[model samples]
Target: MSSGHTAVTTALQPCGLPEHRNCGIREVLDRIGDKWSVLVIAELSPGTRRFREIQRGIHGISQRMLTLTLRRLERDGLVLRTAFPTVPVTVTYQLTDRGRSLTHLVQQLADWSLANMAAVAESRRRWDAANPESMIV
Candidate 1:
């Protein structure tokens, strides 16, 4: 409850409907660690986007998850949602500066996933070969 960090903590307290209390950068990490959150961040990292674009970018993400993720990011002030003055009312989502800064970390994780999948697949093959009897399930 110190006076100095109250505002900062209030802003970044990203865990479970964060309060206007003190929280640090580590809190942001915990919030984004969910698989859907990570994937959403990865999908949107490149640039601003419409809902359809985001849906297309992330393979197999249900519409519900994308909507929820965007709302959370917006609440965290990590995302900027712009509504256009158009016939149907177009909406676009982009990272705020804070969110943009996360691009590198997300990209690195995406790279690692690309990398580790092959290793995992190879490992699975080896494991299966050695444990054929366990495959009955």
Candidate 2:
């Protein structure tokens, strides 16, 4: 390792976990890394939303997929799912304090993606042009 690049140790910090103790981090990422979770989270960030409202906010998400995503978020304690007693059951989803805390993080990620997308696209284009054999159909 270079003198300037210190070797990273297992210190319980995220993005740096001990090999055997990575399950916790992995599980957390599994919850957040999935495409739908962040979108659903963003949709709920503004306020509580009905199932259809969240579905409409996120384009191309199937009803089954949205239900599953909401279930997972609720299970993780990031989202609160409330079922109202109406003639037809009305369900709403909202961010818990934990989920609310993630708003800034998600927004920052969105900002980063926006800022670097062009550079990333160019890099990918260059890589594909240079390494044609490695490209997959």
Candidate 3:
């Protein structure tokens, strides 16, 4: 492997265990790397937002899915959920300090994806043309 690859692998596996056994990174990634979580995080990044606002901001996300996403993010300590006593109830969500720290990384990834989207699409088109039988969908 390249020295840079080795360095990254070593850094990620600081516990000296196999990559599969490294639950920290895997678990966290499994949470934040999900399709909805990043969007939810980015939605909450600007400031606090109500449930309906978040739902409105992210297209195609059902109410149930948004509820579940917020619950998971809250459970993971990446989001802070506040409830206010009102006629019904007012709930707001914002990123915790840890979540804010992750926002930078997420934003960087988002920027990178936007910057390389055309290149990636072209690459995929070429690959798909060359390997039509290998295409899943």
| Predicted structure with the largest lDDT when compared to the true one | 2
TM-scores vs. true structure, each candidate:
0.68, 0.82, 0.84
For residues 1-137, could you state the per-residue lDDT of candidate 1 as single tens digits? 67665455355344345473465656776677777778777777778889999989888888998999889988988889999999999999988898888779888987888989999889888888889888543
Clashing residue pairs for model 3: none
Measured on C-alpha atoms, candidate 1 has an lDDT of 0.81
lDDT (10s digit) by residue, model 3, range 11-128: 5344447655656776778899998999999999999999999999999999999999999999999999999999788889999998898889889989999999999999999989
**Superposed Cα deviation of residue 50, candidate 2 (Å):** 0.9
Index of the highest-TM-score prediction? 3
Clashing pairs in 1: none
Q: Answer with 2 or 3, whichever has the higher lDDT.
A: 2
Q: After superposition, how far is residue 23 of candidate 1 from its true place, in Å?
A: 6.8
Off by more than 4 A, model 1: 1-27, 125-137
Q: lDDT order of candidates, best first?
A: 2, 3, 1
Candidate 2 Cα outliers beyond 4 Å, as residue runs: 1-23
Residue 93 accuracy (lDDT) in model 2: 88
